[model samples]
Target chain A: MRQFFGWLSLVVLMVFLVIGALFIMRPFGEPPSVMDDYIIDNAQEEAASNNVVAAVLFDYRGFDTLGEATVLFAAVTGALLVLRASHKKEET
Target chain B: MSKIVRTVANQLILFVVIFGLYVIIQGHVTPGGGFQGGAIIASGAVLLIVASGSQEIKTWLRERRLSVVESSGALLFILLAFAGIGTVFFFNFLVGSRLFGGIPSVGPNPGDVWTGGVIPLMNLGVGLKVMAGLSAVVLALALFSGGEELEE
Candidate 1:
């Protein structure tokens, strides 16, 4: 009885997700291009980099990269901490 | 690991490091970037570990050293971002200076290595961070499984 309800809920959630995606998402390759067009056209001249993607990542949207680096730092720190604790436990 | 596997990994690591650096340095003019290049170098580290085990690898590629490299990379990245703060945060202040400030001719042309301003430097910093961070994690995991701990 509970299994039936679970399956029904899963199906209903999947249906809702699919419907939402269909309605909310734009078609492929047709993203909102107001900013994209501007970046594509001006990135080279402004950032002085040939690769627009690199320019966008490091120049225009640098804060995002900084945030990403912070996340990586935190994750590595956490992993090292957890792994190092094992040796401390064994020694004591 | 067999002797042949070890020899092959050793020989392949040189090319891997070269190619990863090429990808990272040319990131401003090509499809690849810091993350991709760093991943390639980390794969080289993984190759060494798999061929020789982490015990043999730990003598040089210690966890403490890797942590330092990661910190340096993060520091360089943030410092470069802060350097431009006189104008605005994250400004491309090197756009027209003499260092890496050559403005490439508009439209499709051969890409210049010295034309990326701060982008290439940023790539280098990110590449170092990713390479060290991943290699350290892998080494830590291998060490833990081998009933060892990273040197303090």
Candidate 2:
């Protein structure tokens, strides 16, 4: 009886998840075209780089890229430290 | 499944690595760039690891060598970026220029293999960084999985 209720709740959650996904994907009456044009016009001036995508990623939105690099460095450092610690424990 | 299939797969991986290098080298004018090509090249290494053994891969990824390669690549990238600033940042330093003037502009032709100032160097740096980082990640995961057996 408890298992049955648990399964029923899971099914209900899944249905809600599907509905939420659909809501997010559903297009409005018209798509906004202005944003794309704005991006192209300003991208070069702000970044000053030839490759538009690289300029966007490394120059215009550099802070975000910095944050991302920091996160990656942190993760790598943590993993290396953890492994070193485990090796030390084994040796002792 | 069979030995023949495994051999064929290994040959296919070899072909992919060569093709990936071709893409990376021609990235300036071509569709594929360093990151995409690097990842594909790294995938070939991964295929070797999977087909072979961890010990073999470990031998290939000598810790000191990988660390040196990764560090040097990063340093090179920084230096290249700084070179732009050093040149007053008026124009991109690394982009190739036509040698219209005899002694003054006597350099590699624009859009040539050696052109695109720091782009090729940047690509080389990115390739090293990605390959070493990915190898390190795979090594860590392998170690983790190997350690799991001891737990049980």
Candidate 3:
């Protein structure tokens, strides 16, 4: 039945996720640090800010922030557009 | 909402605005930043909107004005990024100069307010953008649900 297959799939996915988290994934807070180490060591001196996270967001990885802003702009534009259309019909 | 709620919301918004600005301005030395601070401010706006109906709120805040603020914030953010394009995109060009350029001693020490180069400016821009954008969205939703429309 459909219900049986759905349950089977759910169990299968859960088993795989648990195995991946327990065995395959590295321990938490110990990511590959080739780039992180450099950022941590030199961010204050180079970026002239005590907050390394801010330096990373505004200076080091700023292009990502730009993209994020663009995404927000687009989303807001779309929502406004959709909401405006319905109201226009009522006004006319 | 009741009379007491409206009066309390009116009085509390001032402190909310102050705390949000503090979070945004000190972003370079603290845990909070533009987006978080902006969200906090927008929450304050939401509180006001809830206390006052959409029809009452529309007399002061219109979609057109909020859109203008959002656009200005976006423009400022991009302008600050483009200012440093001579050396590289998003370069810390003002690192050693006088304006927000004092490099802090590299270790555990007291935080300095004027040491983030362009980051604080960028934070301000982003904070403005997010605050206006979110407030506009919530206002629009509230208006639509109440059978009202934002002014052109």
Best by DockQ: 1
Candidates, DockQ: 0.61, 0.06, 0.57
Error of 2 at A19 (Å): 32
User: Residue A51, candidate 3: how far off, in angstroms?
Assistant: 0.9
What TM value does model 3 have? 0.84
lDDT of each: 0.90, 0.56, 0.89
User: Candidate 3, B47: how far from true, in Å?
Assistant: 0.4
CA lDDT of A78 in candidate 2? 71
Clashing pairs in 2: B94-B117, B95-B117
- Model 2: per-residue lDDT, tens digit, B1-152? 34564577678887978877776665543455556676787677667656655565676665446556656656665565566676443224534345211111222223334444445556566566655556565665565444532110
2 against 3, candidate with superior lDDT = 3
lDDT of 2 at B136: 62
CA error at residue A57 for candidate 3, angstroms: 0.4
For candidate 3, list the clashing residue pairs, or say none: none
**Model 1 misplaced stretches (Cα beyond 4 Å):** A1-33, B147-152
Clashes per model (N, Cα, C within 3 A): 0, 2, 0
Q: Better model by TM-score, 1 or 2?
A: 1
Which 10 successive residues of model 1 chain B have the least lDDT summed?
B143-152
The candidate that wins on lDDT is 1
